[model samples]
Target chain A: GESVGLHLPTLSVQEGDNSIINCAYSNSASDYFIWYKQESGKGPQFIIDIRSNMDKRQGQRVTVLLNKTVKHLSLQIAATQPGDSAVYFCAGRPNSGGYQKVTFGTGTKLQVIP
Target chain B: DAGITQSPRYKITETGRQVTLMCHQTWSHSYMFWYRQDLGHGLRLIYYSAAADITDKGEVPDGYVVSRSKTENFPLTLESATRSQTSVYFCASSSLAGGLHEQFFGPGTRLTVL
Candidate 1:
């Protein structure tokens, strides 16, 4: 299975605190990584994306860190809110523009506990 | 902002029955994708299209058929629905640009098989 997996099945964080969700991918050839947030009964929405060329990328209140050496990827959300309580998925894109092969990981349910 | 719309926000079907989920996007992004989200298993790509009449299989293309006669329309059909096919289906579209393709996803269509 050319798929990525998360280190934690679920993560619980207090409101106003930062949250970190880790993922490990087996494909060393993968060049792109993306983070997605999915609410209950909703689709996964794009969060932040990182390229193999860079180790980290930041968004509005989110950051994606990629460690190619260990095939590790992590998403950090600042000031976690109840709205952020959803499953976070990490996906990997094989090489360049061919996105049809983007494979997602077994999500990590993020619970922003108030 | 009519970005993407999914029909039959929820569907229930029996085994061996045929079901089609419709997805429409106003962006005309030139790249449309279908994915299924299950417990533990995040968003898995079922099929994708680069443009109308140009479709490609993704990681989980089995038991699924897709057609892209119009760039804004991408429909996923389960030739024979099975209990295993019960999951939330999402449709997403991205720009044709090569780098940093940020995909916008639909709300998702939940399907249950009995």
Candidate 2:
């Protein structure tokens, strides 16, 4: 069975420091990958995404790197803040049909220390 | 402007009871998804709809049923709730515009089956 997995179950970082979370996926057929941030009581929010065609993509305060060769994916947060403390998830979607059906990884809890 | 919303942000029910989680999106993005979040298992897709009246099962849809009578609404019903079904459920929507399939998620519904 194809699965997406996170290396760490929890991560701790200091405020103003950079945080890096890693993920590994099993299915090579997966073409789309996504990163999500979930608060304690809210649903998962989209952070960043990268297609297999691209190795990296950057957004405001966030960057997503994909290494298809090693089947690895990572999300980096710059200047980690208290508000950035939450659970982060990585997801993958294979190039199946037209619709987007994604499989999510376990998750990594990011905690920012003040 | 309500982008996406879920009814009864929290719910509690007994085993064998039937429960329904409501999801509505104003974006009308043409794709809607339902996912469940558990402790160790990050987010598992339960069902999705491509358009009105079009529905399909996702990774974990055995105990759940879904319907897409309208484009804005996609409801998930648990035929007979079990203790294992207690988790947070999220609804997401995405569009294929610009060849991008990034998803936008709703707040989520927390269900506890006692």
Candidate 3:
């Protein structure tokens, strides 16, 4: 019954501004978290990921922050661009005994306004 | 042609009809997964294969079947399709050597059951 969920369904932001997407997960055994970006008519692409051992991880122009205490995760994007408009999903992988599987959240639609 | 690929990008079928979605990956990854993406349900895992002839059920595996006869291919078959089964299906692959958290996804197959 554990799940990963987003705090917002849609977010609108102006160009050149920073954007943040938030997610909450209920699986306490989750050891890895990942963020994915899916453009219209395309498959989800890997963005960034963080391990439970670390609280923050940085990528090209994005950063993933994890709060294990609250079971919250966030993806931060700098200087939002039109190309950045898409749906973003957060996923968690539990360190269970069997094969490793990931649970995905509903996703948040990011709209960049030029 | 080097990455993951899916066949019959779009399909339409009537209820009770049987349909199969084909997926292939050039990376020869050890892990393959099938997931369905719906309006309010992000991506739900349907089935996964850890290796050739090795398969397991995922969160939403009912009404679906999967097989990994070879390392490069993993197909999903719906024995009897229903209107509620209509959704966009994505196939993903991850190498055991490259870490299981990062998966490469194919475009997707859009299935519509009438």
Top TM-score: which candidate number?
A: 3
Worst 10 residues of 2 chain A by lDDT: A95-104
The C-alpha stretches of model 2 lying farther than 4 A from their native spots are A97-101, B96-101
In angstroms, give how far residue B62 of model 3 lies from its true place. 1.2
Tell me the tens digit of each residue's lDDT in model 2 across B25-114. 998788898988888886888888888998988878889999999999999999999999999999988874623236788899999999
Model 2 C-alpha lDDT per residue in residues A1-114, reported as the tens digit of each score: 468999999999999999999999999999998898888888787788899999999999999999999999999999999999999989888888343356788899999999
Off by over 4 Å in 3: A97-101
Ranking of candidates on TM-score, top first:
3, 1, 2
Compare the candidates by DockQ and give the number of the best one: 3
The lDDT for every candidate, in the order shown, is 0.88, 0.88, 0.91
TM-score of 2: 0.92
DockQ computed for model 3 against the true two-chain complex using alpha carbons: 0.66
Worst 10 residues of 1 chain B by lDDT: B95-104
TM-score of candidate 2 restricted to chain B? 0.94
lDDT of 1: 0.88
For residue B70, model 1's alpha carbon misses the true position, in angstroms, by 1.9
